[model samples]
Each structure stands twice: as C-alpha cells, then as structure tokens.
Target: MGRTRTFDVNEALEAALGVFWRKGYEGASYADLVVATGVERPALYSAFGNKETLFLRALERYASNYANYVPAAIERSTARDVAEGVLFGAVELSTRFSDRTGCLGVNGALAGSDEAEQARAALIAWRADGEAALRRRFERARSEGDLPANSDCATLAAYVLAVAHGIAVQAKAGFAVDTLMAVARQALEGWPRSGNTLVAEQRL
Candidate 1:
C-alpha cells in the first residue's frame, strides 16, 4: 500500500501562493515551493502535477481571494463608496505584502513566458471580466438615476481598472501607501455624483 500523505492541501496551496506571490511565477523555483509548502518533491508533484500546474493552482487561489474585493465593496456600499473602497483597498493590500508583490495576475502577465502564456491569458480574461462586471454596476447606477445619464460606464470602469493596475505597479515599485492613496483620491475626483440615492450592488 502507498504511504498515507499527512499534509493539508489547502494549507500547502496557501504556502505555495505566498512563495509565488512574493517571487512571481518565473522567479519561484521548485525548491522555493518545497521550502514554503513543507512538502517533498514527490508529494508536491503527486498533489499538484508539476511546477506550472502548481503555479496555476496558486494563481487560482490568489485570484479567488483577491477578486472578491471589488464586488464585495460594490455590494456593501454606495456607488461612490464602492469606487473609493475598491481602489484604496487594492492599494492597501498591495502595500501590505512584504515584497510589495503588487498583484499576482499583473505580475504574472509581465513575468510569464510562452510556456505560461495560457495562465497569463486566463489572468487577463479574469481581469477583463471583473472590469465588465464593474461597468455593469455603473450602468445600473446610472439607469437608476444615481449617476448622470451621460455617464459612460465602460470608460469609467476602464479608468478605475487602470488606476488599480497603476497602483499595483507602483506598490511593487516600493511606493508609499500615502502616495497610492493620493492616486486613488485623484482617480475618484472624476466619479459622477447624484442626489442622495443609494443601493447595494450585488456581489459577484
């Protein structure tokens, strides 16, 4: 009979995520994963297939945790509140990490090679879908008269996402949290305002 494995898969994945998060996809070696996850090579391969597969799994786990912020903010706050919260929250999270790893997806986009192109594509698609959902939320806000009829949801969503990406990059570059917050504030200066009507947008 095969020896029983004793490691927690979720915990191992989380550890792997931290390694990948700090060092990025290409930078993270199998040795790093082994050290971080406390799993032997054979156990790691048996659980996660290979390095690329393990990295993809870590990416998925990271995305699952990070992608919910915007939707949750939108769901729990007013349109303006949601906009501010999501942008600032991103900056906060990015700066909180020790290496200031920015965003896993954004880092992956820049760091990935042809071998990891599929992972990069999936990350980009996920980001695009997130932006689309935010756009829809803005459209709903406009339709309900919580924003100006002339407000362009698509452009606004793109602008917000751009700001987020910029913040992520800047954070990775060792930018101060105050500077990122200033950037967020500047981005929000363009938000549409309406009379005192608010609704909690649904979570994604």
Candidate 2:
C-alpha cells in the first residue's frame, strides 16, 4: 500500500500565501515557500508544478480571500457606506497583517516580470473591474435617490479606487495605520457633495 501523505493541501497553500503575500512573487524564493509551508521541495514541486505556478495559485487564493472583502462591504451597505467601508477596510487590512505586507495584487504588479506579466495584467484588470463595479453601484444609488443626480459616478469611483491604491502604497512604505485612516477620512470628506459643489465637508 502507498504511504499516506501527512500534509494538508489547503493548509499548505494558506501558509504559502502568507510567504508570497509578504515577499511577493519575484522576492519569494523556493526556500521561502518551503520554509513557510513546511513542505518538502519534492512535495511542493509535485503538488504545485513550479514556483510561478505556485505563486499564481497563491495569488488566486489571496484574491479570493482578501479582494472579495471590498465587494462584500459594498453589497452590505449604502453607496456612501460602501465607499467609506472599502477605503477604511483597505487601510485597516494593510496595517493589521502581522507581516505588514502591502496589497498582494499591488505588490504582484510591481514585482512580477515579463515571465509573470499576464498575472500582473490580471491583477490590474481586476482592480479596474472593481472600480467599474463601484461606479455602477454609485449610479444605482443615484437612481435610488441615495445620491444627487449631479454626482459623477465614474469620477467618484476612480477617486475611491485611487484612494485605495494610495493607501496600499503608503502601507507598503511603512505608514502607520492612524496616518492611513486620516488620509481615508480626508478623502471621504473631500468627495464632492450633491449639486456639483466642490467644497469639502467637516470631518466625520
């Protein structure tokens, strides 16, 4: 009879996700994954094929878990609430992680090379799709009388997404959570009010 394998695939993948999340694709070595996942090199090669394959899988897992949090927040709240939640949550997420790794997709885009260009493109596309989705939600909110007709859904969506990316970069640059939060609040408060007014509101 063949001997039973002791390691769990899902658990191993989760561990690998952490290493990749912290060090990124190009930065994470095979030894790093081996150490993080507690799996033998042969087992990793057999299970995940190669380092690129394993990193892609880890990216998928990271996107599946963390990327969805923003959309989920959108689904659970009003348009304004969605915007605020996503921005604030992103800031919190960047800082809350023990390793303080920045956004996985952002890091992937920065570190991935031509060999992994497709993966980087996919991450960029995903972020764009997220912004578009937010624009649609904002449009719906406008139609539902939740926002003023003059509200520019596309621009607001872009602004919010830009804020998110800025937060991610700042987090990666070692900015404190409080600083990011302050930036988020400032962005939120600066959002154009109804009737095309450009004046900023008082802090919430």
Candidate 3:
C-alpha cells in the first residue's frame, strides 16, 4: 500500500474550488492549484486525478455549497416570487464574496480549449439542468393559473436564467448589488401579465 496522506483532502478541494471559481477551468493552471491548495502536483493528482477531474469535483462542491439557493428560489409560492427569488438569489451569490465575484458554473468554462471540452460540456449540462428546473416550475405555475396559458413557460425560464447570468457577468465586472437588483426589477416588469402581454409569446 502507499503511504498515508498528510494534507486535508477536503480543505485542498475547497482551496482548489476557489482557484477554479475565480479563474475558470481553462484559466486555472496546475501552478494555481498548487499554490491555492498548498499541495504538490503529484499529491493533487493522487487525490483528485487530473485538473479536469479536479475542476469537475470543484463544480460539484460549488453546486452544493453555493448554487443551492437555486432550488430554494424555485420553492417560492408565486411565479413572480420564484422568478424574483432566483434573480435575487443569483445576484446575492454572485456578489457575496469580494474575492470571487462570479458563479463557478458560469465562470468555470464559458469558452475554452478543445482539450477541456469535457469540462466545458459539463458546465453546459450543469447550467441546462438549472434552466430545466426553472422551466418545470414555470410550467407548473402556468397550469395553476399563475401564468397565462400562452406564456411560453420555457421561454420565461430561459429569460430568467439569461438575466441571472447577465447579472453574474456584471457582478464579475464590478457591478454593485443595488445595481443588479435594479436590473432584476427592470427584468421583472417585463414579465408576462394579463391583457395580452407576454402571454401572446410562445414556442415554435
């Protein structure tokens, strides 16, 4: 058998998570991982396989610790509350920390090398899952009369997530919480209501 490990695995992973969160998958280097985790490359490899694997692990950690608010937001009673909850939760999380200002899922792999395609695809799927969750909730709301039957729940879900992602990008670009909140409000005002508003919008 091999020798026992000296470092805290979870601690190292959290540190690596921070590196990946702040820098992104293609941007984060092995040197960054080593410096952040205080672990040598060999040890890191032993613990988490390779950089891609480590990034995937960090994504899991990010979802559990940080992105958990997405589900909570979906639990709101009203469709407007759910949309607002998601946007509010997104901005709060994106700007909560001074050091890491963007979401790990969004920042992890927006666009990168062909070498990291798997990691990039993972991020896409992760984001798609979130959008799918929102779509389902919105569809239920439509069925319950919270939304107009022709509201195009999937489009509504996509719009909410698009705004959420835009705010995250703005947060990374140094936008303030109040500013993003204003943006969220502006987005909400455009939400579908009665009298043939966005109610007329539908899918192809």
- Candidate of highest TM-score: 3
Residue-level lDDT tens digits of model 3 in 6-86: 999999999999999899999999999999999999999999999999999999989989899989989987788899998
Q: Find the 10 residues in a row with the least total lDDT in model 1.
A: 195-204
What are the per-model numbers of colliding residue pairs?
Answer: 0, 0, 0
Q: State how far residue 176 of model 3 sits from its true place (Å).
A: 1.4
Over the stretch 45-155, how does candidate 1's per-residue lDDT look in tens digits? 999989889888987787678656877877844567778878987887788777535887677667567877776777778888888988888888888787778888899
Off by over 4 Å in 2: 1-3, 195-204
Select the stronger candidate by TM-score from 1 and 2.
1
* Native RMSD of candidate 1 (Å): 4.2
Q: Which scores better on lDDT, 2 or 3?
A: 3
- TM-score of candidate 2 relative to the true fold: 0.85
Instruction: State which candidate has the highest lDDT.
Output: 3
Tens-digit lDDT string for candidate 2 (17-96): 88877777778889998998899999998888898888778877877787777878779546767888889988977877
State TM-scores per candidate. Answer: 0.88, 0.85, 0.93
Stronger candidate by TM-score (2 vs 3): 3
lDDT of 1: 0.81
Query: Whose lDDT is higher: candidate 1's or candidate 2's?
Result: 1
Task: RMSD for all candidates, in order, please.
Answer: 4.2, 3.7, 4.9
